[model samples]
Target: MSRARSVRSPRPLLGAATVVAAVATAGSLFLSLGLGLTPCRLCWYQRILMYPLVVVVGVAAIEERSGVARTVLPLSVFGLALAAYHSWLQVTQTTCSVGVVSCATVQYRLFGLLTIPNLSLLAFLLVTGIVAVASWRTRR
Candidate 1:
């Protein structure tokens, strides 16, 4: 009997994270600048957390860094939490009076369910998963 060994690389995962973050960032920018949609406070916060991942993850992927998760995981996790909270606010119809644009307002939806926050949540989730897998692969 012959035994085969499998090797996994973290670069691809990091690359994927970079792409996800880039797409999310572009989408947000397009919404705000191109479509003239005003972002709520929560949306701004989510952008703050997500915009940097494109550069961070891209660099890590290009360099094939082994310890990128240590830096990225915190941001990814926080973004995920914020996105979840924003989505919950929309779902529960909680009114936010902090900014001109209400956090709970659904400006647009992809399929009637995928609002901006939902998309952000999905992107953060994807980045979190990618970072986790990359970190784990490095450990092996």
Candidate 2:
């Protein structure tokens, strides 16, 4: 009896995801630089989590390492959590009274309703979801 062998590679999904992340990161950086909008401390923290994802996902895509998926997914999840909280604080207009930085003073609403932190939150969720889905589809 002969056994069937798989013919597909997982590199495409990883590569695509990486590209998406990198583009989004670049866009965010451009928005910060091109526009005069300064990032708050929490925004910086979220960036710390997001920037690495571009490299990690790119490398993993090229290498096609199973272990990379496992590791990267968790990091993305952490980023998602941070971004979500930051968004919530901004949208709610709640003050970070205890912290050195004030969330309330950060100008939560942008373009009338969309907040800067809200953008970060959405990006985090999208990136994390993509990574999770791609990782799950990856071959062992």
Candidate 3:
């Protein structure tokens, strides 16, 4: 009697999460470079939080480790919070009040709708949600 081998790979959720993170990061990079939209201090902080996520998730996916996924989730969540705050500052006419770079003067908004911080907020939300879903799925 011959035994059948299992052909399934591990951590499908993690793989999907990593792909989303990579795509989000690359898309943001494209928007920044191609559109000549420079990032402010807050935007840079968001990028700092996001750029590593792509790497963390990518490595976790490769290794199929849920521990890394769990660890990285907090980073994305924090990024979301920061991006949201920055976006709010831009759209609401609030002063930066602290940073070396003033978020109030970036002037990247389009039709009073889309701003750099707004884009960052959206990206943060997307990445956080995707990673959170993947984390939940893998918790089983």
Which candidate ranks first by lDDT, i.e. highest?
1
Model 3, TM vs. native: 0.73
Candidate 3, which ten residues in sequence have the lowest lDDT sum?
1-10
**Cα lDDT, model 1, residue 37:** 95
Which candidate order results from sorting by TM-score in descending order? 1, 2, 3
| Cα lDDT of model 2 by residue, 15-54, tens digit | 7778767876886787678775666777777778778888
Clashing pairs in 1: none
Question: Cα deviation in Å at residue 100, candidate 1?
Answer: 1.4
Candidate 1 lDDT over 22-129, as tens digits, reads 999999999999999999999999999999999999999998885889889999999999999999999998688969999999999987769999999999999999
lDDT (CA) for every model shown? Answer: 0.91, 0.70, 0.70
lDDT of 3 at 139: 58
Q: How well is each residue in 21-52 modelled by candidate 3, as lDDT tens digits?
A: 67767866876797866666877787788888
Q: Best-fitting candidate, measured by TM-score?
A: 1
On TM-score, who's better, 1 or 2?
A: 1
**lDDT of candidate 3?**
0.70
Superposed on all Cα atoms, the candidates' RMSDs to the truth, in angstroms, are 3.1, 3.9, 4.2
